[model samples]
Target: MLLEVKDLHASIGGKEILKGLSLTIKAGEVHAIMGPNGSGKSTLAQILAGREGYEVTAGSVRYNGVNLLDLEPEGRAQAGLFLGFQYPVEIPGVNNVYLLKAALNARQKAAGKPEIDAVSFMRLVKEKAALMEMDQSFLSRSVNEGFSGGEKKRNEIFQMAVLEPTLAILDETDSGLDIDALKVVANGVNLQRRDDRSVLLITHYQRLLDYIEPDYVHVLANGKIIHSGDKSLALQLEAEGYDALMAKAAG
Candidate 1:
C-alpha cells in the first residue's frame, strides 16, 4: 500500500470527529470520498496534510512506510504529500510564480536534488498554465489574492503539476466551481495522472465525479466509511441519496 490508515481516531476542539476510520490506497489509483456535511471528510484531508489543532487520539497513518503523523506539515509536503484546500489561502505580497518556484525548489532540495533555475521554472509554469488554460499574466499576480473561485482552484492544480507529489489529496475541490471551471479543473487533474501517482478526491457532490472518474468511491458518514465500491457507487449515491445509505447503515 502506498498509504494506510488503521483504526484512525481524530478530534478537534475536544469533539471527536473521526472514530476508528481506516483506509488504504495503492499507487496509480484514484479514490473518491463522498459524504454529507460534517462527515469528517475535510478533517481526514487535514490530518493527512498534518494541519495543526486536529488531535489524533489513536491509530496510525503510514505513507510510503513512514509514520505520516510524525511529520510536520512541511515535512509531509517534502515527503510527496500535496493537499488542495477547499479555500486556498491568499498571500497578499507574494507573487504566484515566486511562490511556486520557492515551493518547487524547497521540495527538490529536501529530496537531495538541485534547485530548478528561473528559466527552467518559468518554462514549467508556462507549460502547466497552458494545460490548465490559465492566463499568463496571472502568474505575476499575488498568490490567490483577489482570485475568483475557479481561478483559485485552477491555481491549486497548477501548483500540484509543478510539485509532482506522489499522493495528492483534493478537499472539496469542486465545491464552488461552475460547470465550465469544473471541467477545466478536472482536465488539469486528468492530465497530471500518472502510473505512479495517486489522487484522493474529497467531495460532497457527485457532479465532480462526472469529469474525473475514480477507480473507487467511498461513502463517509458519522466519521467512518460506511460503504465503498467502484465508480458505479457514486451514481447510486446521486440517485438514491445519503438518506438511503443512512437507513442501510442503521439496519
Candidate 2:
C-alpha cells in the first residue's frame, strides 16, 4: 500500500469530526470519497495533509512505510504527498512561476538532488501549462490571484504536475467549476495518472467521477466510511441519493 489510514480519529478545537475511519490506497489507483454535507469527508483530506488544528487522537497513518503522523506539512510534501485544496490560497506579490520553482527546489533539496535553474524550470512549466491548455501569461501572475474558479483548479493541477508527488489528494476540486472548466481540470488530472501514482478525490457530486473514472468509490457518513464499492456505486448513489445509504449506515 502506498497510503494507509487505520482506525483514524481526528478532531478540531475539541469537536470530533472523524471517528474510526480507515482507508488504504495503492499505487496506480484512483479512489473517490463521496458523502453528504457534514459527513467528515473534507476532514479526512485535511488530516492527511497535516492541516493545523486537526488533532488525531487515535489510529495510525503510514505513507510508503513511513509514519505519516510524525511528518509536518512540509515534510509530507517533501515525501511526495500533495493535497490540492478546495480553495487555493492566493499569495500576493508571489509570482506563480516563482512559487512553483521554489516548491520544486525545496523538494529537490530535501531529496539531495540538484536544484533546477531558471531555463530548465521554465521549459518544464511551459510543457505542463500546454498540457492543461493554460495560457502562458497565467504563470507570471501571482499565485491564484484574480483567477477564476476554473483557473484556480487548473493551477492546482499545474502545481501537481510540477511537484510530481507519489500520492495526490484533491478536495472538492470540481465544486464550483462549470462543465468546460471541470473537463479541463479533469483532463489535467488524467494526464498525470501513471502506474506509480495514486489519487484520492474527495467530492460531494458525481459529476467529477463521470470524467475522472475512479477505480473505487467510498461512501462516508458521520466520520466513517460506511460503504465502499466499485465505480458503479457512484452512479447508483447519484441515482438513488444518500438517504438509503444513510439509513443503512444508521441501522
RMSD of 1: 0.7
The candidate maximizing lDDT is: 1
Quote the positional error of residue 223 for candidate 2 in Å.
0.3
lDDT of 1 by residue, 1-251 (tens): 89999989999999999998999999999999999999999999999999999999999999999999999999999989999999999999999998888888888998899999888888999999999999999999999999999999999999999889999999999989999999999999999999899999999999999999999999999999999999999999999999999889879
TM-score of each: 0.99, 0.99
Q: lDDT per model, in order?
A: 0.95, 0.94
| Total residue pair clashes for candidate 1 | 0
Q: Which regions of candidate 2 are displaced past 4 Å? A: none
lDDT of 1 at 56: 99
